[model samples]
Each structure stands twice: as C-alpha cells, then as structure tokens.
Target: MARTPTASAGRRSRTKTVLMGGVYVALLGLVSLIIAVAVATAYLPSYGELTKRSDLGQMIRVRAANGAVLVSLGPSFGEWLPYAEIPAEMRAAMIAVEDKRFRSHLGVDPIGIARSVKVRVDSGRWRQGGSTITQQLARNIFLTNSRTFGRKVKEIILALAIERKFSKNQILELYLNRVYFGGGAYGIDAASRRFFGHSADHLSLGEAAIIAGLVKAPSNYAPTADAEASRQRSGVVLNSMVENGFISAAAAAAVDPAEIRIQQTTRENSVRYFTDWALPQLDTLIDETSDPIDVWTTLNPGMQAAADRAIDAHTPRGVQGALVAIDRDGAVRALVGGKDYVDSIYNRATQAERQPGSAFKLFVYLTALESGMKPTDTIVDSPVTIDGWTPRNATRTHLGPVTLREAFSRSINTVSAKIGAQLGFSTIADMARRFGITSQLSTFPSMVLGTSEVRLIDMTRAFASVANRGVAVTPYGIRKVITADGRLLYQHEQNEERVLVAPWVAAEMVDLLQSAVMGGTGSAAQIGRPVAGKTGTTSSNKDGWFIGFSSGLTTGVWMGRDDARAVGNLQGGTAPARAFSAFMRVAVANRPVEQFETQVPIPDWQLTPEEQMFGDVAIDGNVLESMVDEDGMPLDQPGQPPVDQPFLQPGRPGDPSQQELDQAFPPQQAPPRANQYPQRPPPQQDPRSQPPANPSDPGAQLP
Candidate 1:
C-alpha cells in the first residue's frame, strides 16, 4: 500500500540506522576474534620440529658416608618406561578417574570447570580441582605446584601447547611414565616392579587400578602399605571407568581384593641405615644449593665391616643388635643399626630408646666422683627403702661394705641408689645430660638402676666424652657437604664450649671404668689393651648393652628384640661385650696399643670428714637429713621434683684432635687404683643451692 511521503522517509532512515549498527557490531566481533587468535598464537610453543629434551639433568649423585660414589638419582626415584609398554587398563583407569572427556577436549574441559565451580559455590570452599590430565602433565613438566593465578595461566597455556605438539597417545604416555605411584616409584613401570614385581606391560587389571589410585595421594593409597585405602580408591576408579564406558559394570565389580597379589621386591642395601639418616641432611642441602651435592662423612669402611661381622657372629638367630663407634672427637667411625639392614631399615642406633641397664651406672658414679667423693671411699651395699621403693642388687646379695670403685665394678644397685639419693637424682641427670644424653631421664631412685631409656648414639657419645678426657663432644656423621663443582655447602665445625666435667673427674671415672672391664661385668670387652667400659643388662634381659672405649675409640653395642621380648638370659657381658671386643679388635688392628690416662695429680685417697659423714648418713637412710637445714630437719620435701640445672659448658677452644696423646693415652702409666685422689677443690656454695620453700607454695620459684 502507498504511504505518506514523510512516513516513507522515516522508514528509510530507520533502516539506514539499523544497517550501520549491524556493520559496527560485525566489525567489533571480527576485531575481537583477531585479538584472541593473536593471544593464543603468542602463548603456543613451537610444534613443527619438537626438540627432544632430557629429564636426567636434574639427577643427584649421593656419595657414600666416606665420600665415595654411591649412586645417582633422578628427580624421580624410578627408571622411565616408554608409553607403549604401559598397560591398556591402566591408561583407561587414569583417563576415567583423572579426565572423563580427555579424548574430546583440546586441553581443558569446560564442563569439569563448571562442575568444580558449582561445588565450590555450594560448599562455600574450594575443595574440588577441575584440572584435566593435560593441565597436570603440563604442571609436572614445566611448572611447580604453587597455587597462583600466574602459574595456573601458564599451566593452561602449556597444556594447550602440549596438545598441539603431541598426539593424545603421546600425552597419555608421558603422564603414565612421569606420574608418581608411591614407594618412591616415579612411573608405571617402576611402580609395577616395586609393587607387583613385574613389568608395566604385565600388570593385571587390579594392579593397574591400584597403581592409578596411588597417583592421587601416594602415601595414603600405596598398595603395599595402605592396602585397604588402595582397595577403596581403586574401587572408585573402577566405578568411574564403568560410567565412562571404559569397562562394564560387571567387569569392574569382578576386580577382587584377593586377586591383587603384591610381590615383595628385593631391597637389600648394606648402608641403608646410614643412608636413611643421611638423606634428610642431603635434602636440606638440595634446597639450598638447588643443584647436585656431595657429602663427605666420617664413616670408616673398615670399622663398618668389622661391626657388621661382630653383630653376625655374636647375635643368635632372631636376635638383633646395633653398634656405633666414634673417635674421641665424636666422629662416627662405624655404625650398624641392625643385624641386617636388608631385613629392616629402622635405625636402632639412632632411633631406638632402650634401657642402658648397668651401663647407666657410669653417670651415677661420675656424679658421685664429681662431688669430691674418693674412689676408695666406702659405700654400704645393702637394700634400702625410699618412699616404699626398695632397690635390690641384681645378684640378690650385697657386700656389707664396698669401696666406690668396687661398687661400680660390680654394678651394685643398692649402692648406686644410696649414692644417687645422697647427691640427689637431679645431679645424676645433669651429669648424664652433660655427657650428651638427650633422652628424657627419670629422677626417681630407680633411675640409678637404669630404668630410664636412652638412644645408642647418645650412650656412645657419653662414653666418647669420657674417652676425650672430659672434652665436650657432639656425635656427628656429616663432615662436609659440597656441590658437584666444589662449592662449599655445609661443614661440621667443632664447638668450643668448656667441658661439662673436670679433667680430674673424667680421669678418676676412667680409672673406675677400667677396673670394671678388668674385673667386672665388662670383662668380655677386654682386647689386650687398657679399656674403660661398662656392661648393662635390663630387667628380664630385655636389653643388653656394653658401652666401652679405648684410648683411640669409644664404641657402644646393644642387643635386644625389636618387640622388647626377653632374649633368653642374655647379659651385657656375654653377647654385647663380645661384639664390642670383636669390633675393637678389627678397629685397632693397625694402631699401637695405647693406655688410658687414668692418673690425675691429686692428694692421697682419703675421705674428708664431711664426705665420711655424708656416706654414713647415706648408709643410715638419713641422706636428706645430712643435707639438712640448721635445725637437723630435712631441707627438701620427700616428693619434691628436681629443678633443671644449667648444662655443662663446652671444652677449651682448639681443634678436637689437639689434645696431647701422651696425656690422653700414655703407653705406660701407674694402675688407676694405685693413683691417689687429688686434694679436693676448695669448698664453695653448691651450685645447686636454692632457698628452702614449700613446693606447693605458688610464690616459690626455682632459680
């Protein structure tokens, strides 16, 4: 129909306006498309001619404790296997559990992202991850696990590039070979060999599912150790596979727990214990150096071999033992943590805390000697009661009166308890701590009977301090850590704190310990040279220990069952001492016979009137009264807890090996028993002095 001229003009103008707007919108859309293409191109990597890169550049070469080449390790702990060898079931399981639409997506999945976002919104927390298998592979290869926007963007970009560069099969192969599968295994092949004792291509369906489950959390779902968790996670994977059409529901249900067989892989390593202890220290260096490093340790191959031999010869079947030998300077020369490192990797030498038994008497006696008590002084060896706790001698009989040296030699429990009460339990604990004991100590009377637990390394370190003539010692294995290019990373420097004990006290203790080996429970440790040592057997013989030292070396040996089962009447003198003797015989085969410096210049061995009174009070069961207030009443409440004392200072400033051997290990010296005690130092206020106050008094404080 014909319209008015003005109306027709209006219609034409509106049409022209609509046309212009359409053109503008089209231009804007084309520009946006061009910009998006440019950005994607910039982010993409070169794909036409892929340069094969090696993953071995990050390998680390760990040296033996003695600086010899031990082994080289890659960033991952297993050999890489090609994708062609990975089981088809494993590939399907990974795809099902990790990325359901992996075949359809370019790199990422929008559906998965939207689902993860909905989960976070509904739960009000970001617990779910939407990362596809491609994104994870890209992160594993080119980025770290940092959760930042920049890293996530780079991960996405790399994933896209990887998809463009390699086929879907290649991407899946790389993921299978590089993903961790628990037990320090890095790939499918390594995981299969470690868990199933077979090749990747030979993996059963259940085994493959188990391996796939571990990729989520290795420690929590390892099939070998966490079998139940692995089973449950594998069931989840199988369900996902059924839903994704990778497997039938009936087939997925057929994967039985009983059908999954895990073969025990052979992992026999002689230095495994030492390596287990050294690896953590190496990791610290790796974090600092960010490169391969070499660790020079103090372990001696000869001594280590001898220790292994000693354990094998002395320990019976099913009985385990640990041995640690250190020089006077506290450098660990040899360490054997178990009868066989292959059977177990639990480091008993540094990890297990067992009763020292009579071996603990060393600290008790040392404490008494440090308090100005003479070795020849008498201590009544009789059963005594303190707060209803009575300690009896192991022999079930006690001599009426015995000298301190004789009491220590015989390891008389009653006498040790009496002395511990006289000096106070805190003093003994302090002395032991000063000697490098880090284990928690008991302050009860039973502590003198070795009721407390101690690590073998600590016990050995304590003996090492005595062997060094009261020099402070820190038992250490790492000598130095350097990079492959010789850049220094770490060095064990000797500390210069004053020795916690006096030289005279250490010498006297050495003399008494020497007498112990000569005529006491540790006689089995005697090796034709002057040896100072002690033997200890815990209640029911659950733990047997012989901690001894020669002029040149200090060593500790222990024999026990890991379950704390009694070893049929095994005493410290029988097996542990023999082991110590055997190890020392090989350890000192080339060194000349050296004598322990047992003589320190002192006055005649005579008890002072105060000491004699203290001894009498100890014998009469009035030990606390003897250390009484002026009113003849006990100064301390019966059940008052002991206060902690300041630890002993370090030794004189010098090299740990600078001590004169002439004085440290003389070839010929007077018998320790013949040497007289030096005149006691001028008496001063006891460093342990404190104000008398009620323990329950809130205002009372220990200083």
Candidate 2:
C-alpha cells in the first residue's frame, strides 16, 4: 500500500470535481425555483385581492318558507372576530395541532416538511400535509384543490408572498376565518356556531380542541356525522395541545369527551336535510354569487317541527321514517329526513328510493281516469291474473263487484291490477311522469301494486298534482334568493299549470282518496277535517307509506329501515298514517279548511245490490225491511234506524265525521217513500215514564 504523491493528488482532484458537480446542480435548482415562483406569481391575484379575502367573508343564509332565517352557511363575517377576540384556548389548540411553530416559521416550515415526509414514508401513505397555516390560506383563496406538483409549488410561492405582506397575527386571523370546516361551513365562527351553538370567543378548551380537530377531516369528524369519531379526533388534538405546552396534561385529562355538549344547529332539531337538498339546487339555479346571499326556501318551520315530532313519536326503534309535505303549488312545506339528523344525514325523504307499494296506485287510477274511467265505474275485486302474477287483496277477502271508488279507498290489489292490465303498464308510467315522478318505472303488471321503487319526494309530488286538481306540480324548495343589499338574485316564477288530467278526473280521484281516509285502511289518518290519501304497505312489510292531502297541503310519510330489512309488521295505515295526521294537525292548524271540489255522489254511488253487499253506505229501504227476525211479529218494538246504528248520522260519537259523510254521499232530493229509516228501536221504555199501571212495577219493564 505504497501511497505515492500522485495517488494523493488524484483523490483530491476527484473530491474537487464532485463538489463542483454538486454546486452546479444546486445552482440550477435555485434558478428553476425562481422561474417557477415568477410563473406562479403571475397567475396569482393582486396583493389587494388576496388581502381582501372576499370569498372568506361571504356566507349564505337559508330562510324558512316563511322567510325566517333557518341557518347560515359559510363564515359569519358579520360576527367575524379579530385575532385579539378569538378564544385564547382555540388559538392555542389550533397552533398546537395545525402548526406548532406558526409564529417562528417563514411561510414554510422545513422541519414540518421533513416530519411529514418521514411519516408518509413510514406509513406508506400521505398521513399528513406539511403545508403551514399561511400556505393553507394561500391555497384556499387562490387555488383549486388539485393534488399536482405544480399546485403545491404555486401554493408555497403564494404562501411566501402572503407571509411577506401580512403580519403573523393577520395571517392567523385570515387562516382561521378562511378555513373550510366541512358541511358547507367555511370559517371558525360558523363552525363554532354550527357545532357548539355559540360564538368562537366562547369556545371551551375541549370545544376548541374539537374544532381544531375538524381542520383535518371535518366531514368525517363532525359532531353531526359521527360523534364518537369526533370525540376521538378531539382527544388527539387535546394530546397535541398538552405536548405543545398549550394546556397542562392534567387539564386535558379533566376534559371528558363524553361530557362535551355538541349542539349541531341553532334550532334544537335540524333542517340540515332540507338545506342539503336545497344547496345543490342553488348551484344549478345560479352560477355563483360574489357576495353573501339569502336563499328563501319553501320550508315551513311550524310544519317542520310537527313533522319532526311525528316521526320521532311513530318511527320504531332501529328503523327510520321520512315525511315530506308540499303545498298545491309544489312548495315543499316540511321535510323530515330521519328521526334525528345526527344519526343519519342521508335524507330518506329526498334520497331513499323504496317501493311505494299501493301508493303508486295513484298513477294507475289517474291513467284510468284519463282513459274515460269514472270513480263510480264498476270493477271486480275478485282475484285477477296479469301474466302469471295473481294479485290478492290485503284483507284476503273480495267483493264480487265494487265501485272504482270503493276499490281505491280499500286499496284492493285485484282491482288496481285489473285496471293496470286494461290501461297497460306503460299508460300508468306515462301518468306518473305527468305527475312529476322522475324515477325510472317498470311497465310490468306488478308495477300496479307499487313494485317500482321511488323517492318519497317524488311520490309526494305525484300526489300533490292530484291534490292540485289535476294540475302538475314541480316540487321546489327554494323560493327566492337575495343579496344583503336587497338585490334579487333569483325568484321562483311559476309558469302556467301543466294540466296532466281533466279536472273532473282529479275531483273523482279526490272522492276516492277521501273514502280511504273515511272508512278504509287509512282510517288512522282521519283528522277532524276532510283528508284524501292512500295507505301503502310493501310486501314483507319492508316499507310503509301514507301520502295524503288536506287543506291544500299534500303530505307523504314513509317508514322503513336503511338496510331494506323488514320492519316487523309495520303498515302504512297505523304508523305512517298516524304520523301524517299528527303532523297535519299542526301543519294545517292555521290554514283555512277547504273541501275538495268533487262531482256529486263521488261516482258510482248507486251500485247494484251485489255491489252494496261489499259494505256500501246508503242501503236500500227494502234491504232494511228485510233485516228482521223470522218471528214476523214486526220484529221490532219498532221504530228502528235503517242501516247500522253508527251510520244513522253523518257524524256519531264513534262514526266518521260529517265531512266524510258528505263527501261520501251528497244529499240530493227527499226520499220517495216514508219510513225509509225506521227510527232506532225505542230505548227500553223507562219505568218512571210509564203510566199508573207501571208505577206498581217501577222496577220492572213497562208493557
């Protein structure tokens, strides 16, 4: 190993060459960075534009159908707080979790980047981002969320520019105000008010930690989405705060996640589902608004509250229910997505597509009506076969011949199937389209039995058309939009009513629907006033529904589970109908009561004797005379009411209401024969009223 001077010289030369090559590479990288920054800067907004932060300052408020402020999405710029006013705990929690060395860093943190790279490498995934608060603010305001190397480079350059132009406090304030907090929330204040139901200044240590945790994955950890997941994420922030000395370890431990009170909405219950539905419509209605705007929705708060209560009271455990109420003009009055918005945000009213069961019969009947079928037309309730599918009545019994009105009110499957078969399934499907059902429908015979799945809103809207007297209704939630300066951004202007069927047909359908609520499966939906609706229970009891209209408002109720499992023995008549009545009682409490316009006698009022055998009201006097004992001694003490005692009066203590009776059978002229109604058998004669012969036997029956 003789090391000559030449060998030593060669090693030194190689070292110098390596150093020069590294220097050239470093210099080229620096020049490239400068070029990239210049290009990115050219694409960026002016400094004044960035500082103004208009997007951060703007918000959207949703109003009730009555114009009451329901909620505000985006930052509450009206209540925007200065850095000095923001809660110290919130600031500390944010600084500890989001950027530990925010104050010391210059727009970008090398240490943080190194840590992020190390974490991604160790975990084989991008577990965390290395962008500082300033970089996030820059990205949020000036760039789209494209996960590209170019975007990241621009983000860093813009962050540096922002840091140069603003102070640390200003950067923090802007970042806090501009950060997205999921659920259409854009700032700390809105998030605070939305989740904690208070101002940002009032956030507690635990609350602050939870809010800080929301920065990473707001939707996944939002209190409304998953309270448990939110709590765990908040715990991580609390630990981070402790590690950063922002809070003492003991203090963090004392804050129990379970005890945290998470108020999702300013109102105790949520109209979030309603807003969720309306927001997408906003996107389609308007391109974009530069300033904060107000969306005047068609939601009735009173009705919404009633809907909430009704669903809460009736929906069975482990199952869900939805209710949607619409006015004659298709204004969505009230909508309940689920019993609680926190448990589920998937709106069953507007989202879930379940079998409507017999509710879809509305289409079949409407088709028949348009095809010259009257409500009074005769239909056989006996078993019928369409293709190979045989339809059976829910009661497992059938009348030989029944009026169309009777068949509909009773939701007789055989009758509806036969009508569908006659009209052709495509005819019914076309009727459904005319009524506003946008979901795909089948032309199969079973579709008459509501085998086709549909959204509750679609069914409600379809019913709404019939309630609107055959005029088509397009269900809408937003009424108008306005800016803070009262400039109209959007206003709903109704065009001419699209007449889907003849008015008389709608009137006859109303007559049939009223009968259902009067004395049919939908009896549970009967309120004091007139109601026209139908009951729908799908096979295996998977879904129950009642869609009806009263006082110019159409309401539809659906009860089911999320997994499409059977809901025990739940039926539309009992749970959904009761819920509809309970909600309508309050929803229409203030609205004027109006009766549906119908042609007299509700069509087919005078079916043959065979038809009357199927429980017709208005019995023949001859039949009344025939109801007697074989003794033939006049069979009566004798003044006896014809027909059942309950049906003697339009409204008895336990009988259908007067409106139901009038709707059932409007009075025409006086009866031709006397004694048409033999008065009810005289009550056992009172002993005290009897003459002197009865006085001796006061305790005995009077002869």
Candidate 3:
C-alpha cells in the first residue's frame, strides 16, 4: 500500500535516529573498555618490578691444592649478552618454537589461547601451552609454575603489564638470559657454552637449535643425556623455523643435528668425593653469606688418585673399603671414603664405626709403658680367662714366656688382656680419649680388643700422634677459605697438643711397632723405610684394618662387607697391608727420606702414683736386681701368674729342664735405657727425676 510522502518521511527519520543512537551507545561501550584496561594496567605491579635485577644462584668453585678446579656446583650463567649480541638465528629458532607470533602479539595471545583451549578440551587434559615468551618470563621471574586458574590469571596480568612496560628487545633479552638449561646451567650463555663449548655469540645454527629445544624439558632433551633425542627435538625446532619463514627451507635442511658435538663438563669422580667431604666444613667457619666462597683443601691429587687405584685394585666385590692418609702435621692428604662414591655416598672413612680389633692395643701398651713397664718385661702368653671371656691369640699357640716387644709383635691377645687388666680399664680409657677416640668405650675385658667401634678418621688421627712425637693431632682438610672478593673467611692451622705426658713413651712405642712390621703379623706392611704399624682383625673376620706410618706419612686402611658378613679369611696383613704399601709407594715417591725423631726419655714425675710408691721404698740394688728374672719378669711376687698350666718348648712338647728354663729367662745385665728410674733433681713441690736408661747401673733400680 502506498503511503503519503510526509508519513513515509517521518517513519524513515525515526529509523535513522534509532540507527544513529545505536552507533553512539557502541562507541561509548568501547571507550569504557579502553578506560578499564588502562586502569588495570596502571594498577599492575610497578614497571620497576620488570626492570629490577634479580640474583641468580651463585657458582661454587672447589679447587684442589694444586689450583685445579675440582668441581663447579650451582647455577652459573656464562656471560650476559645484549639483544644485539645474541645470534639472529638463535632468536628466530626460539621465537618459532616457543612463540610463533612473539613479535606481533601483546603479552597474551588470543589466537594461541583459543587454539590451546580447543586442543585441551578435545584431549581432556591441559597438553598445550598458550602463553607467549613474555608470559613465560613473567611466570619465571615473579610466579611459580603452578597450573591453577589463579596463577594463570596472575600470569596474564603480569605478561600484559610487561608488554606495556618493556620494549620487545628488552623482553627477549630477559627471556634468553633467564631460561634454565640442563646440568645446573642457566641462561642461553651457559647453555651454549655447556653444549657447544662456545659463547652464545659464536653458536652455530645447529648448536643453537639443539639448545633451543632443551627449553621444553631441560633434563629430557639435554644433549648430555640423549644426543639422538636432542637432535630430533632440534629437527622439530628447525622445521618450525622454516614454517614460520624465519629461515629458508634449504638452509634448515642443510644443517645436520648429528654433527653437533655436546661438550659435557664432567667432574672427576674421585675429586667429587673430596669435595663432598670438604663442603660441609665451610659452614663451621663461615655462616650464610650471599657471595660465593672459595675453599682450598689439603687434598693431594696424586695421593688421591693413588688411593683410588689402591682401593679399586684391592677391594673384593660386595666389599667396601676406606683409606685415609695423614701427613706428619696431621693434614689429611688423601681420603677415599668407600670403594666408589657413585655406588653409595656413605662416607665410611668419616662415618662408619667398626671394631678396631688389636689396633687398639697401642693404647694399652702405652699405658703400661707410662707405668714404668719396659718393652723388655716378660708377660706369659698362656691362656687366661677374665669373667668367662677367654681370648686366644690369632696363631692359636701360646708362647709361655715372651718379651713385651715379642708379645706386641705377635699381636698376642692374652698378653694384651693381661696388660690391660693390670692398668685398670679406666686408665686405658683415659689413654684412648687423649688420643682422639670420642666414641664411648666398653669397659669389659674385650675393650682391649677394640670392642668399642670407632670412625676410621679418628683412629688414623690417633695414630698420627704417635708419629708426631706424642703431640695429639686433629685431622683437618680445609686449608683456607676466601670469598670471591678476596676476603679471608677461614684459614686452617695445624692443631697439636701434648696428650702424652712423656715424649719418650712415643719413642718406645715406635720401637715395638717397628718389630711388628719387621717379623710379626704386620711384616707384609714393610716399605723398606723403618715403617711401624699394627694389624687388626675381628674374631669373625668381619673387619680387617691396617694402620701404619713411615717418617713422612701415616695411613690407615679398612676393608669389610657392608652387611658385616665374613669375607673368606680376609686379614689386615693381606689386602689392607698391601693397599697401604701400594698407596705409600706413590705418596712418598719424590719426597726426601726421613727418620723418626728420637723420643725424649720419660721423667720420673711422669710415672703414676703407684709407680712412685716403688721409688720411695728403697731396697738394696742387688736385691732389687735379683727380684726380676733375666726376661725382666718380677719373680716370686704375691699373686704371680701360674706357670704349671702348660708349656711348649721350641723343639719339644713336654716341659723343659731347668737348663732350658734358665736359657729361656736369661739374667739381664742391665735394663733398657728407657726403663731406668731417672736420678732425682733438686727438690721442689713435685720435681721429676732424670730420664730412665742404663738398667745395669745401680741408679736404674725399679720403683
């Protein structure tokens, strides 16, 4: 139907007005959205958050005594590179693989997010990441990698804020410099140098591709772990680059991933053991300082290598071994904790506690020596029971009468027990404590047999005192600790104390120990340099130990199964002695030969109160001389050990005649120079007499 011109014009005018009004409302809504975005961006964390410098993990450099880098632990970025310094190909590869529209997109990519959401919905899991490089950098710096919706919101806000605050080049530089690589390496510089042995500026196309691929999963695609997997990942990155038009197809195809040589920074297995032991020592001297620390250790690389070889060559399968070498000054030169550090990190040398067996007899004899008993004194090796605990000699034969030196050399258990009983368990314990054994000791008769367990390190340090002329020594490893800025934090100094009252006692001990290596159980340990040591074997052969020293060094070796099972006839003289010999040969190859210093004779006041009692009761020199047998055994004493139990002469089974007995106990013309009572000096409150010597002299009478 036709309408009048005025009515049609009116309806058309109303339609036009409605259309114009709708356009005005849409424009207002758009302005409001822009204002809201501007407000949110303004309220976001200040721009300084994106520009502030953050501290990356510091690098810890451990060096050997010779200035060789033993290990580099923690995160260390090789060098920081500006955006222009990074190779263009590296940037292209990272952008193509990590974010295709990195240059054009705001921090949050809507198209990528839509794609990721569709894929996640289809696969029923969050498989694909929709964030751009800016988002990743934001998360890495200010947020954790949690998959919660709140974290996603925070990431999107921070990414958009970063886009508003930082330039594209600045954002890219931060991303490249902060990304993590495998093997404790962080940033492109570190990744490039670690994988290709070249700086980031010199990275080849193929090398750049391999490093870029590690961003997805550093440990999984690390070149050191699986070169083929890393190569395949690099191929994917190269294809992405080509598809994104960042590189030509021909150029991408020309590069071969197989030719990329991964330069792996491998720490020496032996050096790692040393570092592990030394790292904890730093804390005692220095507290938590943000700066990096330099710890110089006393480990001798040559000696460490020698010790490693010795343990590997001598240790039986399923058996663990520990060795520690200490120099004359108590410096730990070499320490091998176990057969291998990789198989287990349990440091047996410093941690494990096992019976030292006869190695503990050194303390008992020292106590006896301090009590004025000479090494020439006779002690019956016949079997004796203490509290129903009978200890037989390892050889299973008793020498009816033997010199104290002979008893020690043979490692006679009965003689050691008798001597320990004579000194009283508490006295012996005090002696051991002074020598550096901190573990609790059992006071039973078996205590003399090392019934108490002790760490290998402590036992070795204890023996070092004997080597150092009676000065107690504490084992130390760290030589000095300095910060990166040249501040001295700690400097280890040798600590020595006079644990033994009489320095000459150490000399007498040296004599007896030398005899053991010369003709006794430790004969196999002789290294042709006047060596002295002891052999220790538990009853069931569960533990075998050899601790010995030359004039230059003292070493201890222990071998046994971890489960405490017997290893077929393993003795201290077998593998342990051989290992000691093998290691010492290399340890002292170029050093000058030195002899043990003569120990100053013990003074009279150093004797125990009981020993002084004898000095006070003066008797005729001839009578005192007659009282002791030729072998130095006190004769006709009250409570003398029974002699009729058993007797085995050298060439006969039955008891010998009086002539044989006389021959066995020959009269001593003079006591050992070390056994003589010192001549009394001018009287004081408690002045000691002269040193003991010249037993045949009338002044050498026993107390």
TM agreement with the true structure for every prediction: 0.55, 0.57, 0.69
Scored by lDDT, the top model is 2
Query: What's the number of clashes in each of the models?
Result: 10, 8, 6
Clashing pairs in 2: 376-603, 376-604, 639-679, 639-680, 640-678, 640-679, 641-679, 641-680
lDDT of 3: 0.78
Using TM-score as the measure, what is the rank order of every candidate, best first? Answer: 3, 2, 1
**Per-residue C-alpha lDDT of model 1 across residues 427-518, encoded as one tens digit per residue:** 77767876778889988778888889999999888888887877767777777877645778788778664455667778889989999999
Residue range with the least summed lDDT across 10 consecutive positions in model 2: 686-695
Q: Cα lDDT for residue 375, model 1?
A: 79
Question: Could you give the C-alpha RMSD of every candidate to the true structure, in order shown?
Answer: 17.8, 16.7, 13.0
lDDT of 3 at 103: 90
Off by over 4 Å in 1: 1-58, 71-268, 282-287, 602-703
Task: Write candidate 2's Cα lDDT for 4-121 as tens digits.
Answer: 9999999999999999999999999888866766666566665446445465666788888766668877654435568899989988988998899999998899998898899989
The better candidate by lDDT, 1 or 3, is: 3
Residues 1-703, model 3: lDDT tens digits: 8899999999999999999999989999667655655665677555445433335656676667775545668765566678899999999989999999999998889999999999999999898889899999888887899899988977877787778877898889888888887866677886876677678997888988998899999999998778899999999999999999989999999998878887754336666766777788777877777665667888888898899999989887778999999987778889898987777888888888998998999888887786767777888999888778898888799889998899999899999888866667666776787677888888788898888898888889878888877676777788887765578988886542444435677877877888888899998887767789999888799999999998669999999987889988788988898898899888887777777654454344544444432332221112256455798654553333233334345447566766877676653354435433322234352221222223344432221
How much does candidate 3 score in TM-score? Answer: 0.69
- Model 1 TM-score (2 dp): 0.55
